[model samples]
Target: MPSKSSARHAALTVAVVCSAASTLVLTAPAHADSVRIHDIQGTTRTSPYAGQQVSGVPGIVTGVRTYGSSKGFWFQDPNPDKNPATSEGVFVFTSSAPKVAVGDSVTVTGTVSEYVPGGTSSGNQSVTEITKPTVTTVSTGNEVPAPTVIDSRSVPSRYTPAGDSAANGSVNALTLRPARYALDYYESLEGMNVQVKNVRVTTATDPYAELWATVKPSENRSERGGSLYGSYDSQNTGRIQIQSLGATADFPVANVGDTLSGATTGPLDYNQFGGYTLVASELGTLKSGGLKRETTKKQARDELAVATYNVENLDPSDTTFAAHASAIVNNLRSPDVVSLEEIQDNNGAKDDGTVAADVTVNKLIDAIVAAGGPRYQWRSIDPVNDQDGGEPGGNIRQVFLFNPERVSFTDRAGGDATTAVGVTTVRGKARLTASPGRIDPANAAWANSRKPLAGEFVFHGRTVFVIANHLNSKGGDQGLTAQYQPPTRSSETQRHAQATLVNTFVKSILTAQKNADVIALGDMNDFEFSGTAKVLEDGGALWSAIKSLPKNERYTYDYQGNQQVLDQILISPEIRRDRAFSYDSVHINSEFHDQISDHDPQVLRFRP
Candidate 1:
């Protein structure tokens, strides 16, 4: 992987490549006299010059990356080419930092290679690089090529071309169509200097000093100035990741809706994360949009307020307890019942055998009371150490927080992480055999993931079944900018099975009693329109409450310049039949740079 720095020299240039270290197979070098950078790039995702040797490739050094394991410098040919399908710039991969500086015109002889950023299995497009180069500086202080402007007119409305079926839906062999597809257009400008003026931020700056902005500000934009990923077919092409090539410390901290005023100049590059990224050498001024965090109105006197929030691996070592408590109290308005996900053990990521989270849970409860909120009580089962997949020894799980004044917990005995919970009939009414119990814990579907925790709660003498879940994440899924046209979501298989189990459990409860109130809510880690959600809503077992809001306001997470729905609250017919429920996806964290969590909390209010 590439290294990051906080300072830069007088020559302003951005390193566009975030390449992984790779080995090259040396062979006899061929003498190709008529080859240029564009000829090496060809017009496809893979270069036609791949595996072939070329000599006397001439270009001016535009950027020099002195750090990172894959130390290299990007050079651009100043000569003009009529075809827009081919890029004039390419990176020369040197084992160590190249002695060349920016504006140095040099001739290189090397073998053309395609390096995949995250390995071949990532499905990401390979980067065209000249590996094992012999560089000879012919002149110094030569002018670099002019940067191409990236605006709404340049990027296409279409995302990508249809992949070839013969290659398992891979677009790697497709010819470049710069004016038609967005991915192709970006590919045409790969490793070349580009600029975007007055771009609107779609995703906040993350810990890696990277942010995303949209060239087409009005294309499928949400009301809050963000691009919406409503479905697989609507992949917005205007969004592009922005990372600084100069000083990481000098990168602007931006939030969604903010503007990077003036021209942000950089070279267009492709990486493992976010597909097409602009590594900025010259940054623009940041103008705040004044995007404030949203607060939900207080629930009515007779209404039951239930919320789901992923605390993002909360433990005693975390310092965001006060801010999180304030968000729960003032921003969320203190829901009657709050389902918390990613509640880590007391030691956080320590690999100790301790699985109890009493210290972690108690600290948050105390902070909530200190923030002028209710005296909340939490209930959760400790999992076996190193079994649940998370931050190593974090042992992250779901926990329930209920306000004693507005709700009452019905605790049944013999509930553990390994034991499965089942529904039973008590006096002709549906009830859980073990309250605060795991749902199908031993099932293969939940192998390294958090099992659903079923809890029995009472609101004004009405029984409500709440299942908190933190399903397996979409870790192995291919990205939208992958070499495949429609990226494969390999991680969905486990989520589908997990959802099916939850749906089956809900169906079992409803079968025991016709009008049982059941609410399954948490970080589903899948989109609302995904197949996983379809399986959960199968046989009319439950309906996603997030659909109650407008399509533009349905997202509970912002990722990679797309406002999407990953966390949701699905309710049974007993809760959805009556149109008395009000749902709010409170926008507190996902849109802000200084966030306690990456997911926004969701609240559902209804009268039983």
Candidate 2:
């Protein structure tokens, strides 16, 4: 058996009492040696008397967890201790459904145990519980404890404690300073009934029947009605996850900027998905935010339109092709040229020695035409087997799709999947020697990463160089819900290095020709406000087109409660100086629950 101190912090704190077994009203006086629920919960995650047998634990039954494998009930002390650090409630875990009723005052005799939900190997937190319980009814028809009121003021303004120097620095430690950090505040109330009133939805409802809301409105709010998600800032301190404990059908479908009018009363619980969640039995009515999807941009014949979309690992066997093709054609309005990312090998995820993506690309083209769009011709270089980092055996790579009638690809010889592409000056203009070639394929920055694909295209006698990229992803970065204060973005170092290489290549093109029409676009995998993006925008060589939008509206991806920017299209100095470019974040996905991809495609129309 593992020691209780070694377990992570308790995620759930349920306290329950035994009900009357017979019709006879049991009237027994409280025992003098009875242990309080607050003492069992203590100020820390592990119970003070863990692994020891305790008798006469008294409380009123509050809730019953009848469904799950760890069937248990929650009980709370009617008169809680005045200490803010110690919680007044705890969970009693039983092997079977607890035969208890709300308002039943009972004394429990059980062995205190620290129950890890997913076992020791999962790295998940444990729930402090009392197992092998024997219930003895002390009295019947007792009043339930009043719920603690929670609002902006009750929640601390600080999002997290200071580094390890602070008293409450350790996230798993029981030393909670509820008055200082919001995480500590929630931890202090773990498993206790709390009420949140007049909250605004910060994120759209997820498929798991949950939504995030802000207790108090802030200045950085979106027009759609939710708080704008700041990057690890204390401004998002009051944001909390709201989960419906009942049926998924009982949960209301809502978008950001929506309102939950009445007070939502629930127990404060912690889980692996979201750090702290309010498991609500009573939910407030949802009011619409009046948010609507944006209209597709109009295409002009005088200018050429280019788009970048991450199809999310498209393969010949996947059924999402039709939906993605429909989005590209109907939602994005069929740009003259499109830079596609995450195109998988012909066999999809099958690890069979297949490295070709021709079948996969053809299926998407056929889907585009079938969806009432123009016929699109594709060009790409097959990546080395399992060298590019993505799904195993998927061999995901970047490809370009263009309408042959509108824009023609300037394909030259000597370009393969592994070889690097070189830039040359032709007729006093900078161009790629190979129409579709990899840029610095052997660069250490692109180790186990997708190489940038450079393609030269001509639309109406004007030459434009487009570099399609799928930079390093945020795979190994610490999660926002991690146990660390201001979690580190470990993947950014690689992305920054990748950005440097792309910036160097763009500088070479500009050095050769002062006013080259260059457009770099794709899923860069870093935010527009991130340092990785700054590396790509150094010295005015390229300008992030997404920044052209208003500060509140600049987002192409939505994660948690934040509408953030991950995919971007950066243009050269000539394109930005002319002021002849217009761009739109075609909002066909990312906001809705049934999205074709996690990202929304971006389109840029400019007169080169």
Candidate 3:
């Protein structure tokens, strides 16, 4: 974990419990005379010697992190205690480059502290550290601690035990049962040198010079060699993050199905991003698994293909326009109507009150034409300046790209960002009052989020309603390694509200005309099994089409090590009752390091 800032350390003058189950223990003496590493790192999440001084702590340096904001050297005690719960290693925070090398026997005297990354507001567990240290090298050329093998046998199949119910579901106070739970097993060896051999890469190498691999290759493994995250209960415990302690340029690039051949030795450190990360002093050799991107079949003559792609805050200045265009044209097989999310304004985050995305959309259309695809016409409403919650001044909103030759846009006038779209009966058919209109944009659910863009289109002379949405993100949700068991997801409130509003709008359309063909699709930003999806599917208004795919193949986004679904396409009963439609989550981007966007695009093909 990163070193606790001076401000945070100063603010934490007294012992502060990291979890509800943690309490300040004054049972130990005021100051430890000769404290071992395991003595300082007790059996719980918080050290018993926290906020107390320890002198002459002896250990051999296992790894030295010379870069980043949190520069420190990890050392492990040569002799371990009888109990397996207490860790025999600890991180000595130096605030800068540490003047230590691996295999150097050193004696450290410092204050034992628990440094919580991302502050206490983030529900992350703290990393035990010794801050403001005075280091003395006792000897040189001493051997480092023998690396512990973290294979399938070491990591338990069970992820975690139930937290103490009285302590707000916090497992901090619970004793570490290393053999029983995977989380406890990792926590027991925190800051200790560990090794993994012949591990399969679960997530591709990211821009941050990091990758994820799993010790247990078969645990919820996807067909494409990724660990699938199907539900909240099944967080794959064998997956772990790996980062190099060397230069970023020296780090090897890898894909999802790649393998880390040979032993990769590292100190297991806890961080804010991925909970337990191995900062590898010795990186494994990257062996390609030959994983290739997938392509979906082109829509047939009678089928109307509708696709959704989140262009990851696309703007005029981005060089990824060509790649994104290729993905839509080649990978997605050129869908008839594509819902594009995160299309930035013309100025592209310049903050000059420019919210129009005509330049952006037209540029993409031109690129699509250049890529030998159909000339797609676009329709979208410019959101209020800085009102939509994305990159500040970017004004990210959803746009529709329709093949004019295959589909005709129903352009009813007078639709703006704040105007609410309603359904009305026109010649015994359901018609949107404003074609390409916002769905309750003024509602509190869309306060700082992208308002759902509802559009009316005529596909092969049949009227179809498509509502494109990019709901509130899961920015503040607690991670799987949070201090509390079943961490809180405060961001779901807004998404649930937004889903309810969209569901009501769909019901209104169906109420106007019973068998109206309606398809609501975009970056839902929630899983298929989430409460938000349930709300959208409530009252039988719509059903998520992605559910048709088998559980292992239902992912559109890859996070850390788990392949999960954050984007969805929901269809009305009239369209889904027959089960004749086809859905494809084209995995062109998420599992590759050369991705233009982080999320893979999804396509739905049906006759409307």
Span of 10 residues, lowest total lDDT, candidate 2: 18-27
lDDT of 2 by residue, 1-608 (tens): 01111121232222122112201111222222468878877775556676667788888887676764557777778888899988877777776988887778878888776554333333334456667798887777887788788897898877766445362233555477889877778777877877898888877787668888888777366655555553556346777888875676889787777888898877777565555678787799988877776656767887898999988878887889899888888888889999998999999778887889999999999999999998999889988888887877889899999999899999888788778888888788887878689988888888888999998899888889899999988765655645555666778888899999899889989988999888999999888878988899998889899888877777777766667788999999999998488988877676765566778899999987
Least well predicted 10-residue stretch by lDDT in candidate 1: 1-10
Local distance difference test, each candidate: 0.88, 0.77, 0.88
Prediction 2 global C-alpha lDDT? 0.77
Summarize candidate 1's per-residue lDDT along 401-489 as a digit string, tens digits: 99999999999997998999999998999999899899989999998888899999999999999999998998778989988878899
- Could you tell me the TM-score of candidate 3? 0.95
Off by over 4 Å in 1: 1-31
Candidate 2, residue 347: Cα displacement in angstroms equals 3.5
Which wins on TM-score, candidate 2 or candidate 3? 3
Q: Total clashing residue pairs per candidate?
A: 0, 10, 0
> Against the hidden reference, what TM-scores do the models get?
0.95, 0.85, 0.95
State the lDDT of candidate 3 residue by residue for 29-145, as single tens digits.
Answer: 357778899998899888888878899999999999876567789999999999988989899988788999999999999878777766667777888888789999989999889
Q: Every model's Cα RMSD, please?
A: 3.9, 7.5, 4.1
Superposed Cα RMSD, model 3 = 4.1
Error of model 1, residue 238, in angstroms:
0.3
lDDT for 198 in candidate 1 is 97
